[model samples]
Target: MTINPSTLVDLSHKLDSNVQIYPGDPLFSCTPHTTVAKDGYSVHTLTLGSHTGTHIDAPSHFFPDGQTIDQIPLSSLITPLVVVDLTSRELQDRQTITWSDIEGASEHMSPDVALVLRTGWSAFWGTPRYFSHPFLSRDAAAKIFDRGVRVLGVDTLSPDETSYDGVGGEQGFGVHEVILGGGGIIAENLNLGGLMNQNMIALVPLNLEGCDGSPVRAFAWKD
Candidate 1:
């Protein structure tokens, strides 16, 4: 007997206090204004960072001359995704994800496909341990850019490690510069582990004009 298509599993992580947010980034908060006991209505004022929770990074995030969230092409935001798991490394190892990693994980990466990296760091959400983890290296960023991939997603904070310091010299600006500079979009803080199938992933970002990035409601579906 086959199960109905509608009966398929739909796993989504709730955007709440339990969700781990990057340090120095805005936290999700809601201010209750009206309640049933007061004005017979319920309302709330929500506040959060543009990069809060699961979100998409516009080119402007890294390049001052790049396109903002509103200017991002819809074609690049939603498409087939290849899930690349890299959970073998320990936490905050500063290990860089190289181009070979991508090639080793998948056969071919199309120009329209979104690359989702699963670092298994999502488990450390809501704790100090979640702040730092293995990130993509500058070489990897160059490789993805060379391959013509416009969108990249990671299950961590930024593509750069937390220990990275942007001080003197060409410090702290490697992978992001290569990716965003190449006009690539980034989706950070995603929970891609819940999805079993790797068919297509839908990335929906809040349409905020002139904004570098915006919070997103990202999910994956398989038929």
Candidate 2:
């Protein structure tokens, strides 16, 4: 079972109307205007939030002075990644991921790594169950920022908890502010459960100028 470079694994979730979105976010929709039988061409009108499905959150997503998606460096999108499994803890107690969790996972992390938190929450993608789960704590976010992580990703809709009154409510904004303010990007709503081996990830986002964020086609390959 020697994996080679040609082996590609898609780490992104499929975008569709059924996919769950953050509360108050725009719903995904598509309408076909031309079909093979009608105009011998296929055309569709698609609509979705910029952060829909597997997408990158540029600095401007949170910080007004942050860089837009078009300004994201290509080197940051293509890099070595380390996947830390949080499924067991999420399923057992729905506990918030914290700095300690990142510290424990860092024993195997590299200097320039893309940290991915796998909470197995993607299983609830199309259901109401995905929105109410525990989220990453502000402490965890600060620790990640302190560690100089280039990119942060999670299986959940957001790293911050949904309850506006929760502990991370205001602090969570600080987290986004810290990371994006520091030129780091956040990748949300990812589907990385199927990827096993640690390898290189390719994150390609639409080149939309001045846009806060954009949808992305994220993938991984190993050797």
Candidate 3:
């Protein structure tokens, strides 16, 4: 089958020094190692956390012996995508995305398919409001895993509530613990706004050995 590259929808945020990062994480920096004029070639030295920008969290993110970024199968990163767009719901800051809110998607949840929660939070990417994105409840995450969903994606910093200045301090990181502890993979900070009729997706991360996570060049296309 012939597939046009243009038809693929980009689902990753562009990485730069200005990309909003999770609090306490390493800041992204790109410095020129060699300039074309001086060295006859251009090379850049990139410095950033494994989970910087659009990235996938391997099971190792939470479990000490779980699969690492390089251990995950490439085929698992590329699969049919099932999107649950919640932008129309007018989600509030630090709101909990309960199971009932996504119960309708139970039918599509599976190990072979990638489930993406589109909270439309990508719009606040560079501001403090970006950290106030809606998060999935631990019960909801458990339910998703119960359905054999090993891969999950979200258009936010995390599926769990972003804790800031004591806000969301009680919620903890239950969602992350549940998913990652279950040996599942999570793709975070995705740019799902451009997604329309696309079905399949590829979230290819770097093969960083023993790394808990890695940035991915995520994209999607219709079958």
Candidate 4:
């Protein structure tokens, strides 16, 4: 069934000067360039990291010769989605979403679908805990990539562990490399709280030439 436009649920986290971002990355800023009081119109200038809040990471993000953000096709941006809920049942000490969790989520999977992983991390948007939220284990990411999934959207800043290395700090981007290197893109920092049961999603990324990533305004449609 076709979903009504009015029923589209926004799956993007609102971006602002203080939206959670990767540490050491450029801070998001929006300053008034023109005010209605003076110019009869309002305009604001923005400064932000390419991979800022609610953004899509193109293949070029990790692979030097990968596709640029502008090269992402409309077909790739809009697709049927399978929201995989992994956090609702996890224990406090469990942070890595292993392959078993993914297997459980995909028992009735569809082909060529985008998988949106919800970790319940969106609830901590303004806190340090958000940065330390659950991540997809490398083994799990490898399975997803092998399945030919074109896009992986997440409610966390990364699918990779943000604070720890392999033994406690593995700098190698295992998830990013597997997904992007496979010609698959990733959408990060999503507001998936309302999308746990969603079956479709649309990602509209800014068409910036030669860009590696762009903040996207995402939405999910009903079943």
Candidate 5:
């Protein structure tokens, strides 16, 4: 299907040296490899983790033998998008988002569409506050997966709480385990503030063979 460029709303953060980096993850950097003044050409060498910026986590992210980034089918990259707006909930730091907060949006939950949780956390993307954004409860993750929704997206660094000391929260990476273990996908660090109630979005990742994840140029548009 051809998507008109005019209708696209970018859902990805601009990647650069200052791009928000998850704790313990590799920092992003871009250095000039060849300069026009010297090599008669320009080229850049980028250094970043596979999960840097707006990215999709494949099943292999948590499970060793599961499908990898390159193994994901292209047909599954774009789909109907369901945005669950929870900004009004006034969720607090490290707060847990339960099923009750999501039940209202269940009507749109299904296997084909990508379910994105918009917590308005993208506003804090470059600040320390971003790490304290609300997280999904384990039960909530399981329920979402049970509904047959394979693609999960979040505006925060992760669907689960961001661990600072490498020690996990009570729920751990339950959200990742539940979704990816079920052969699902999880898109993180998305800029979803501009998206509408319903639309079509693409979370296409790079074909990085045997990789657990890849940065994606996420975008959405209303049809």
Candidate 6:
């Protein structure tokens, strides 16, 4: 079903230097490669990580044999959606989001739906608190997997704790492994406060071939 044109919510975060990002990731930069006055027309050069700002992570982000960002199916990117708001509660550092939390926000998990978690974390996007935003427990991820969810989104840096490492070890991003590795995708660092009981989401990402991830223009809509 198509959403009514009257009700559309922009679920994406504005990308700029001021926007908070994962530590050690390259900072977003935009420069005038040519001036309008001198060069007769304006030209710009931009540089940033593949996973900057409001972005979607392909399985390749965590798995070596996973699909690239460009390989993501449009049907998976744009589909029915539901947001579970957890902003009212206190979600602390390294805190895990239990399955009970999911059951409290919404009664049913539709198969193949893009499930979004709004932990009210984006409010602290420009500060360190953003890093401490809520995360999904491995059990919660498993629950999501069991329910046949197609994609996941969170208003946090990641659904997994970013304080530790897995670069050369096996203790990797469990949430990502559970979802993306299970034939699902993820949208991170979203600004989903404007959405309200939406039914559909359109996540349009840059068609960057062979890339692990790409920034997205995500929006929520309903009939």
**Distance from true location, Cα of 157 in model 5, Å:** 0.2
Tens digits of per-residue lDDT for model 2, 1-223: 3546566788888877677776677889998989989999999999988888888899999888889999988888888878878766645324577777667876655448888888888777777667765567777777777767869877777776654324235444555666787888888888876777757777889999898888888887784
Backbone steric clashes in candidate 4, count: 6
Model 6 bad stretches (over 4 Å): 105-107, 164-172
Instruction: Name the best candidate (by TM-score).
Output: 3
- For model 4, residues 1-223, the per-residue Cα lDDT tens digits are 5887666789888887679888677999999999999999999999999999999999999888999999989888889888887666752422777889779766544446888888888888888777777778778888887677879989888888776322333534788988899888899999977664567788889999999999999999876
Better lDDT candidate (2, 4): 4
TM-score, per-candidate, Cα-based: 0.85, 0.88, 0.97, 0.92, 0.96, 0.91
- Which pairs clash in model 3? none
Off by over 4 Å in 1: 1-13, 88-92, 164-171
Question: Could you tell me which 10 consecutive residues in candidate 6 have the lowest summed lDDT?
Answer: 163-172
Clashes per prediction? Answer: 0, 0, 0, 6, 0, 0
CA lDDT scores, all candidates in order: 0.73, 0.76, 0.92, 0.82, 0.91, 0.81
Model 5 TM: 0.96
Candidate 4 has an lDDT of 0.82
* Per-residue C-alpha lDDT of model 3 across residues 40-144, encoded as one tens digit per residue: 999999999999999999999989999999999998988989999898999999889999999999999998899999998989888899999999999999999
Residue 134 lDDT in candidate 1 = 70
Stretches of model 4 off by over 4 angstroms after superposition: 91-94, 107-111, 164-168
Sorting all predicted structures by TM-score, with the top scorer first, yields 3, 5, 4, 6, 2, 1
RMSD of 5: 1.4
Q: Which of candidates 2 and 6 reaches a greater TM-score? A: 6
In candidate 6, what are the lDDT values of residues 1-223, reduced to their tens digit? Answer: 6678778989888887687767688889888999989999999899899889999999998887899988888988888887787877767766778898887644556665788998888778787667766688878888887877868999888888766343221234788989888767889988876878778888888999899899999998885
Off by over 4 Å in 2: 1-6, 90-94, 107-111, 164-172
